[model samples]
Target: MRNLIHVLFFALVVSFSFSCKEEPRTPPNILFIAVDDLRPELGCYGKSYVHSPNLDQLAAESSLFENHYVTVPTCGASRYNLITGQLPKNPGDLSNQASVSNIANKPAGERPTTFMQELKQNGYYTVGIGKISHHPDGYVYGYHEPKSDKIELPGSWDEMLLKAGKWGTGHNAFFGYADGTNRNGMAKEVKPYEAGEVGDDGYPDGLTAELAIEKLKSLKQQDKPFFLGVGFFKPHLPFTAPKGYWDLYDEENIPLAPFAEIPENSSKASLQNSGELNQYKLGEEKPHLDRVASDAYARKLRHGYLAAVSYIDAQIGKLLDELEEQELAENTIVVVWGDHGWHLGDQKTWGKHTVFDNALHSVLMIKRPGESGQRISQVVSTTDIYPTIMELTNVPSQATLDGESMVSLMENPAAKHWRNTAYSYFRRGISLRTPQYRLTKYFRDQPPAMELYNHQNDPYESKNVANEKPKVVKQLMPIWKKGNTGIFKE
Candidate 1:
């Protein structure tokens, strides 16, 4: 009898131990959020002006990347590089319809494999929402099907104009209905009735958030792992947000650009360039005004941008809250990234066209199950996201990705010698950003442009030390060339 009891207790102990020791499930669901044209100006990145409480909370719980950059500053180029995990060879004049139409119009299998396609192949239900593409067609980024049952939402201003029928002049001015007939009759600057209320009926970000919450609820009931890409279309242009968000910041309290005064010897290459003019389209409608002389107008523009950011942040918070409510937070990996950075009157440039820090640097935050809450200073690019996600989710990706995976850094935030420098490029300019410096070289056809900023000493990039630091420039120029050649191989 004694031996029988001892054997029974031993069997129970072994069974319990095995149950506890069974390998924890490694396949984690992925929640990927891509915000458009967002600069690293959040409270998490040490900016005090932007009210990003949810993002700040997320940073504290995630592995925050301090020196993350985009492959290109422009919309189409950056998106193409990010989705393909490769640098985009200058599409040049071939970007028009005549060139693209001749190529096959088939979906994922016919084209280069995207990160999304890889996920779908690995038995993950992949879904995309909102402005995932720079174009209106929205078939470019390898999404095989639309996730939502609703009719496709209008993504751009042109689409909105097509629906509303001559709504307002296509300019950055307060727009209201000329006749008080509908919700369009409401003042553009008027606050919404409530914080979460939706007016104007067709706000894309709010609609995207709504659709994502519905998807998340559905995924919760399913047994299979999933990949959800929720793309927000706000804070990009038109700067239209719920009026409550616009009311969040007082115009008087809005912070001015760190360097509002353009120095007398500022880069003529930057000044003569119509980068800002192209963005604002001043001469097309109204006479152009000097940015320096129109600080008030600039402030209004900044206010609108901040409002749009806050509105997007709120929508993101809603989706994240749904993930938590559905008990997916423990098993899901969330990555929030901006496709590229934007410019708000920086260097007299209004949009993302230059190789400046404001244009090139993007915000990347990765929150995994068991990662440390620390900021990583190593330089990384948006190109790295594809490989990192694949590795983390244990999905097999056959495509040759250009980026080196940072999976090691996720576990050990202080991994040494991971990467030395990160590279970003525009049409004819290339920028190499290291921990201590940034060096830019523009093609001679445009202007004899060179900018060198010693980040260790001058974080704001105030002084142009290119002429003074000839030896440094020579050393860094080769590094940039090597990076470009190594990545593109053309």
Candidate 2:
């Protein structure tokens, strides 16, 4: 009878051990979504016109950053910074060239290590879809098989529409001139859309979303975690979206550009140097565009831009819904970011180029599992994204990354020792943006020009107090120089 009792006691102990055993935790998957030329006009960003319910909902579930910025305002330059976690210092300003050029000329094994490459090294499957780069194929970024199934939007109207016999006009859209001679020379060619066709119907943006969904479904069947990048090309361009999205906003009801009243003491060079004054007019140069008469046209252009933004938001909503339906939300880390911001008549600028706040500031939303929804007002840069993903996935990064991990901030939004200021630079200028101040130094052959603004008092960046506050400029200059010490050293 004692032997029988011993056997029963052993069985009970085994059962208890089995019940208490911990299951292995699966590494979190990463869904990296990149949008081109998007500004901080989302519903969560306090903009009334742009309807980004999906992003706002994601923000509700994630950590939204209010002061996120990019290293550069151009697509290729900014993306290179994010992927490599390093400042872009390509010779000949090669960093801002189209992706195709960068990839083709990339030195063997010298390609800055990308986050996707690190993921692949750590045993995660990496998949890329859509305009991830300007490259003809996406392999340069490290996907094993760069999927090329993306749909082409209308090509240059001159080439695809007129020359192909599909449309009457065969001219390129008016992008700002390259030489600054015509001020309206053909920047690039774009296919003309039919009278009522939506931008996404023919463009690759919708197809990119479809491919992302398909990739996610395939990922669900596999046991391994994945790094899936979905890039959309809408809102970058010929101001096209489906007729349905356009109809959502009445042109008459569209808001006008916020009135910009230059101070009497402001330099004439500052006012005349506005990029908006020099944009292409009907695909040709009109030097008088900077004069007062162009205001009405500028208003119409802004309306089209806002409509494009809203349309892209709808497509984003579709992708987010799929994640929920597939049951991937709880296990996936969703990161939504714009490659860079766009300009809409701010500081006499119609597009990105200058190192102004409107160009350098971008929208960055991160949704990590188990994190409460909140806004992080700390200054952060695109370079931080790669390191953050590495920490979350438990993956070993092979390359030395320059960005500090924001995992601490993710766990505790009030975490201290965060960056005091974020750094941004272009070819001829460097900008230092902190929560309270912004200082810009533009280098020319002549004496360097400076602009300073107290963000606390002038949120619109309307005033330049550099002359009035020389001491502040002197203090910040060294700090900015220190942050950029290693940038051009190599």
lDDT of each: 0.66, 0.64
Best-fitting candidate, measured by lDDT? Answer: 1
Candidate 1 residue-wise lDDT, 1-490, digit = tens:
9999999999999999998896967489988888887988788998888888888888888989989998778665676666668765554311322113222243324455668767777777766665444432233322222222221212211111111222322111112122222122332233211222344333556656787888899888776788887777657765667677877788888876675433333354543243333334322222121534266666677787888788888888888899999999999999899878876766655667767788888889999976657788888888788899888988888887878788887777677857757778764567788989988776645444677888897776667788888999988887777655432222
Highest TM-score: give the candidate number: 2
Candidate 2 segments whose C-alpha is farther than 4 A from its true place? 1-18, 90-94, 98-104, 136-195, 198-200, 259-289, 446-448, 486-490
TM-score of each: 0.80, 0.82
Q: Which tens-of-lDDT digit does each residue in 1-490 have in candidate 2?
A: 9999999999999999999999989888888888878878888998866767778888888889888988877777787678768765543332554334444356536455667767876777777765554431242322222233321111101111111011111111112111121111333332211113534533345555666777788888877788787776656655656666667766676665563444323433333343343433342332221443255566556656766677667777888888889999889999988888765766655567656678788889999877679988888888898898889888878777767888888777677788757777764667788888888776544333777888897787778888888999998988777556334431
